[model samples]
Target chain A: MNISLILQMAADADPERIGLVCDGERWSYRAIQRAAHGAAANIADIGCSHIALLDESSEAAPIALFGAALAGIPYVPLNYRLADTDLAALLQRIAPAYIVGDVERAKRLAPEGGHTFCSRKDFVAAAEAAADTASGEEREGEGIAAQIFTSGTTAAPKAALLRHSNLLGYILGTVEFCSATEDDAQLVCVPPYHIAGISALLSSFYALRRIVLLPAFDPDDWLQLASAERVTNAFVVPTMLARIIERIDEGVQADLSALRAIAYGGGRMPPELIDRALDLFPETNFTNAYGLTETSSTIALLGPEEHRSAHNSSDPAVRARLGSVGRPLPTVELEIRDEEGKSLPAGECGEVYVRGEQVSGEYRGKSALDAEGWFPTRDAGWLDSEGYLFLAGRADDVIVRGGENISPGEIEEVLMSHPAIAEAVAVGVPSTEWGEAVAIAIVIRPGCDRPDDTTLRTLIKDRLRSSRVPERIAVLDEMPYNEMGKLLRRQVRAHFQDN
Target chain B: MKPGTKLKSAVCDTEVMVIRGSDVEVMCGGALMSEDTPAEKSAIDTAFAEGTLIGKRYVDSDGSVELLCVKPGKGSLSIGGASLQLKEAKPLPSSD
Candidate 1:
């Protein structure tokens, strides 16, 4: 089934239900369906192989997404924040396309000039005005629905393909159709390019929840909108949550009692920050979702009960569950494998491998799944006795000092526990004596005195093995994170390379 | 029938998409299902009037022929005079 079936079913079930809210305008389910069909006709007439969106979050996002699916073309949401050269390279890769966003920017970045361009305003208007009849060829379930570029924190981005089957399986397996009440509204602030953003749109649509789009994220603006819209649910990255918490700390309050659930992912959540958030929003249910773009979205989730139990538990093992991303979804199979490619037992840290109907480990021109269909996530992690999965940093981020492999996440967690440290990242730097040595960068908390390197090293040495201690520490005003809140360790490693 | 083919009931508003292919004729409200819209509504068969639910999947006893109800109406899905069972929901928390 094509992804358009989702919107079609929703519209058929209740055409008059409010489906989307953006900038004071409310759109019903039938209206969005009509616009989607219109957009599909426009896309098919243009005869483009793909439809690309280069703008921030807006009404055009869902329109272009479903339109591409209905028109039997892949929807590629390009990162508008990319540099001119980088953005141009991507545009060239998906050339002979119908690009939708800023018409002027699309014209300026047209590589080889084979692509068609339309302004976001014009696209939405044309879609609304076109015929409501289905206007495209039937698309198969195996067809590529979206081509998302992975967030390249350590290396160049790869175009990951998510088939219609993969995305539909994820939605059908996780969400109950039209389960949301009429009053429920979800506030979406994540950019359109991210997997979380895409899945949020699809899942919310299927659940029949009214979607409120925030084109850009600002802490005050987010709080105000949530309060004004009575947003019942929201999804945020760790960085966004931190900023929102900071805004709350400044005594700027809105009647956020309407907010009932908040899910966070896209980055690691600091234990302290989550604890503070839990206390601050006592009535809200918290969920921690963990997945990659290739996995189609979340493969595992730490649900609300798990959050509260782990937070209030006195046992170390139970409390440690707070750091876990919870067990794999019942529909998914997860295993930890060692460097030798053998499956590791519980509590053994190794690379994560996952297999499921939703796991589409396919990139442009290549498939990353093994013969048995397991996709090696390249993420270092371990499952506890209770099946809770705790993620280390990326396998590539592991600091190899001499013959020992040290997870930078371990050392960073220790450093971040310090009262004065706001954020920390550990990386491996070249060392003649030991082949490589641990180096750390830290961002101090506001108004807190910076700790000496010796003091920090002593803290790590006390909590971990001596070899895990950093040989060098650098204090920065802030840690480098990509737009999605993923820490860029490669940039941190660069800081100590020349020293 | 082939997977992904949509069929509407000749007797009611019931609509379904084939999720598993099978050669057996499918029936809704005791009337044969077809791809075309019915010219007019027919009398609902009381014997098979249990009703179909939106978003619910119905499968044969042996689980060969599966149909997902896309539009609900007063018609239960069946194959060869036997009513299809509603597939059990797999309870999973929303993660997106």
Candidate 2:
């Protein structure tokens, strides 16, 4: 069954189950599904494509989404948080039949398409009307379901076209992994448009679980809601989790006893934060999910026990492997390869390649896969002696000193341990002598005097090889990052390159 | 001046006008007694008559219905009644 069918099933199985909760307002599954059908009927009259489009919203958004599925129209939720320009670029790439969200922004940003932008009032009314409709059986698969954008290691953001089947696999796989049942309640803090968000939603939908939605996230509210709603599961970002741990450090109580699972990915979680959360919520299971939009949501997950043991492993080799995103997820294949595309041995560090039911073949705008039918993840990491994966850094982020390769992540991880430094981002700055050298940008902790460039360089030299020593250090208030909290090293380098 | 020239507008009453081919004033302003409109603004009071969700709940752009705790301003919408409220409902950070 496709996504809409899942919603229909949930409505039938437990009509009174609270499917949506926002700001103390709650709506049952039946209420939400009926409203979506009304949205679908109205949308069908305009007739863009049989695809339902949702712009991120706080309330009444999910109903419209479900209504599209009822109409047998594939629904695509666009990420509304991006800058107007980036959003426009993604809108162009999607070129879906219709759209929803900031009507003005959507109109201005997405003008070329033969689509319509329904205003906020009209949409709310549509949902209300649809809510009165009796249960209707939704038809099977039709158009594309969702178009999620992945940041390209190359030029522009690449749009990943996801079919109903794509969503089906992600949702079902996650349910099986987590043993999700009807008893679960998911607090959805991530934006609806991201692949990760969709994955979490689909999994909850399949398990007939209730979803507590948060339009945007604040660390405090997240904790409070977990306690108040007794939310069983949640998805958080590394940055968000780091801040939550910071709160824990400040004597915040772990009121999240009801939370069963906390899944995080997007970027590497600083080891310290994970350790802190494990100690705080000893009963809560932790999952380290790893994937790009290209691979549904996550192609691999390190389970709570395995993850903790890996972190606590005495052997550096064992710990490294455990820290690595655990072995390929069920039905997924992982391989490390050299430049020639020949698969490398288990322990060698090279481009990490994945292939699975969740993996897509091509990028919407460009060819993501090489001539050999494999997409280069552009991430540089080595499979260890134990079949564990340890990511060095992005292959593009690698620092090439003449011919030697250096991982900037290593330097950043080391610098982060310094008492004065709060956050660090290391980039490969262009060089005249060597091809590229490590350049460091540090966000110092409050009350600490700015560490001089010489002092930082000396610090690196004392800890690492001379080659790994950063040539310069610039003090920044905060490292620039995308919404997912992944540092944009390319942007960081560009910001200071002229100087 | 064209509708685009004026960067902002105010709604003086509960209803405003939206030109099919022009900027339409939407439900906005959080829980305030009055809404202002620019000189170029058109009243869309007819939407209240035609709007599907509003007759029962007075949602001002946001799908909020005078809830005690949650408040929102203008909600965003997609084509064909695809809408959602814009809430400042991020979990409030507390001093731990």
Candidate 3:
């Protein structure tokens, strides 16, 4: 069924169970439901066919969220991390019926139309009282829930059209994979507005789990919640995992006994990091979940045991397969295809394609899926003989230095093997000779002096061919990473563009 | 590295009631290096200069936001329409 039904089921099963938590406040299932009802009433009164709201990390997030769903109004969670100009362009693109936020800033920013702005605090206060002007169920609230923009490196942003079904799939699939229970408590470090974070919060509501919202990700607060609240579930990116692991490496200790399952993946994860975590939190169940906004959240997972068994790589094949994305979930049918859209045998690298109830056929204002309805993930890699998927990187991210196609991840993977290298990213920079030249950027371990560019290039050259070695190495005080811990290779590419 | 020090702080939503003459600036998440989506090319334009946030609520790429406080030039910036000033503005207390 849909997300609305899932929430109804959970509310019916346990009305008093804690559904959400923020700061010192906790919203029980009944409380969250009433607040959702309040949101619907407010949406109706405010008169928005489609609304764009900026903040979802607040206590009012869930109410305004489900309220949009109940009101049959499509809502766009504006990406607050974007520069104001880009946001201005995006807001101009959508021209939302009404904008939602606090009053102080709106008057300063959009002084032209002060009346159109709605205070989130006011909506939240009204929702807490459960005022229902509509007063009843509106079953056909089949309107879109969100228009999330994919981070476009090569082109303009494309808004992914996510319906209630798409979001429900993410919630249910995530809940099932984690085996979430009523007693489970969620500590969300990811922003609630992003797909991964929003999905975590929605899944909590469906499972009647307690949720602690963080306005943003902070490792100290993360560890504190895990130790204090016995947080059972988390959604994080590999970089976040890397940072936490680094913290521990620096002699900081955290009691993570409460964590049960964590869903991860914005990009690739270093197997070494996973090995370390398994040792660090043996009690916590870990899953490497793979998905895109096109398919909600997770379409596949490599369970803890799978990680444990496959990690010991004696054979080159097994070692390579250790990097596998694991098997496709029951909800999805995954396939490997060549450039012609023809299916390929196992162990051959090709574009990964997914078809499922969870996968959407098109993006808003654009079509992303093929004629056959398979969402062709531009990621290139092979599915091993045992049906395990290994990702090289995005197909577009593959750098052709001279005639040889080189995956930046391959070079970075080898660079990461150096003990002193804390994080590494390789990107292709334009060259007059090679069409594109390979360049490397690195972040060294704290307190450790970085290797000179010559030594760093020699390090990669020793493991790889001279051609595979980076033409230049730039060591920064820190490797730039996002909230989810993924490396921003595109940003790195821009550095070498003019140089 | 003190464990408790806030690593980064974004100026989310702000009201400009007073502009007392400070260099109005905003620090935003320039997190595109790690993401593969092609649309992230707009980042250069995304970095908000002090002058851009005037009369505009700047939304970022990741959904975390900072309202551009107009630094009227020198003393302390204030909300243009409201009475609040940087001196009068109270920091949102830290939460667990």
Candidate 4:
């Protein structure tokens, strides 16, 4: 059940196969295993319960990952983008740990916790030295494999624990071993802290696909590497895809014939962008992966065929499939439930609940799963008659106007349909008459005159009910978003309220 | 070997996990498999000397037993003195 078992399986099956490409250097499966063995021994020597990585994507990511697994400790990947004070505070909370990445940042932590620090190079060297001396003994399967702090889009961050079994269960159920072609190379642009990054590594390792790493995502660099590495597969967030399409439209030409598939998620994708991307990459398969960190990356996905069919379908219902997250994975069971926890019928908006082998509903000290094994995702969504999951905004994002629950997603979608509106987010603003009213922060298309608030309200009113029309509309030059592409609705609300 | 039992090759670096429990002997390169570090290399049995590939599962003809090759090795997998054939891969659509 150990996550390292996946890497060992790949190395055992094809020792000479290339496993990773970083900094223009190729790493074979055997090479990674050997490095992991060394790194594990070093971690074991440190005698820490956790190994935290505070750096960007590097060869050290996988090494520290598998190495921590072999050592029977949880591998924690911290968001390297955190402010110094915030990062130090988090380090203190996870102290008495073996910290790898930026040595200087590690040294800045509180000294009373007995935390140990080492540069990635030093850790690799130490692991290499201990390779022959360390035992690759198998440990119990109950050990934690990784601890990722939730992105905390709406609230304070919480450390989520992913056990060995949860991760292994995901790979076993979703990915077939060695299914990818030897020529397949996957370009990974997500940071190490994200669940997609971890899943990409493990799945690619099991499939024996050569991984090409992008240290940081710049659309141009992503395109350049995709062409140079002949990347056949890749994953990007919604924002990255938008920027790439923008670059392509700006006439940056690079042959991307080698790319066979592209998966995008981590935030809501604008249908217009997906439409352009589908037209731009006619030969490439596109997938809309939907999952939370607690669900181990992807519990549901809109597959390539569905995307193509939905795009070509003329029926309004079928064409609307472009906005859905498709069906749940075979390994997962989905339930849409009301506040009373009663299962709701199709087309009924409710909280999204899921249960599966891969779902780790436990944070560091709390288990969120109910007695029946259903974990409420706290995300508002609905399942249509065809079982397509349409995500509304977060449950907290619901605006209550005179006791009527209004969905911000619905209003935002309507606003986005306007030809002049580029991006829009609807949030609940304080209202004396209606408890809370719909207020929108919008980004208008460049060089387009701002649409009057009355016009925007009329557009939403015509499409939906009059109650759904936004009460306030504040135009902005750009929308506020976190690095992962999740709309910062809280920030948007604060901005509107302040000005 | 029982299901979930990890067996390391005695002749080479091949490792496998028993997917279907069985009493048959799991051999790699004409040598008995063990859960610990394998014994020194043994002479390859000419009939079953074909190299094993990583991540491919090998199973008996009766389908009573299966082993997922965890690591590739110079030794091919065999069960009950009969060489096991590589199982055909099932390609699941890429999710992420």
Best by lDDT: 1
List model 2 lDDT by residue over A1-499, tens digit each.
3466556556655678777687788877777777777776666666755342445544555665566666666566766666788777766654555566578878877788776777656775766775565355454544346665666545776656665555654553345312345566788888776776766666665566677887787777787887788888888888988877777678876567677888888887776677777777778778877777777777766777776676668977666544577656655678888768889997677788877555664554455666655657777877766566678778888778889878787798778878888889888888899978778888988998777777777778889889998876778888888887877887789866977
Per-model lDDT: 0.89, 0.63, 0.63, 0.86
TM-score of the first chain in candidate 1 relative to the native first chain: 0.97
Top TM-score: which candidate number? 1
Native-contact recovery for every candidate? Answer: 0.52, 0.00, 0.00, 0.63
Per-residue lDDT of model 4, residues A240-334, tens digit only: 99898899889998879999999989999889889999998998999999998898889988989999999999999988989999889887999
lDDT tens per residue, model 1, A1-499: 7889999999998899999998889999998888888998888778888899999988899999998898889999988999887888888888899998977777787747599988889999988877455564555533999999986765678999999889988887788889999999999999999998899999999999999998899999999999999999999999999999999899988889889999999989888889999898888899999999999999999999999998889999999988899989987999999898999999999999999989999999999999999999999999999999999989988888998999988898888789998888889999999999998899999999999878997898889989998888888888888888888887888878765
Give me the displacement of residue A447 in model 1, in angstroms: 3.9
Off by over 4 Å in 2: A50-61, A69-74, A92-97, A108-113, A127-143, A151-154, A177-183, A248-254, A311-313, A365-367, A370-373, A417-420, A445-466, B1-96
Q: What is the lDDT of candidate 2?
A: 0.63
Q: Model 2's DockQ?
A: 0.01
Candidate 3: segments with Cα more than 4 A from true spot: A111-115, A130-133, A139-142, A172-180, A246-255, A312-322, A444-469, B1-96
TM-score of each: 0.95, 0.75, 0.76, 0.89
Docking class of 3: incorrect
Q: What is the interface RMSD of candidate 1, in Å?
A: 1.4
Give the CA lDDT, 0 to 100, for residue A107 in model 3.
Answer: 43
Superior candidate under TM-score, 1 versus 3: 1
**What range of 10 consecutive residues in model 1 chain A has the weakest lDDT sum?**
A133-142
Q: Could you list the CA RMSD of all candidates, in the order they appear?
A: 2.2, 17.9, 20.9, 3.9
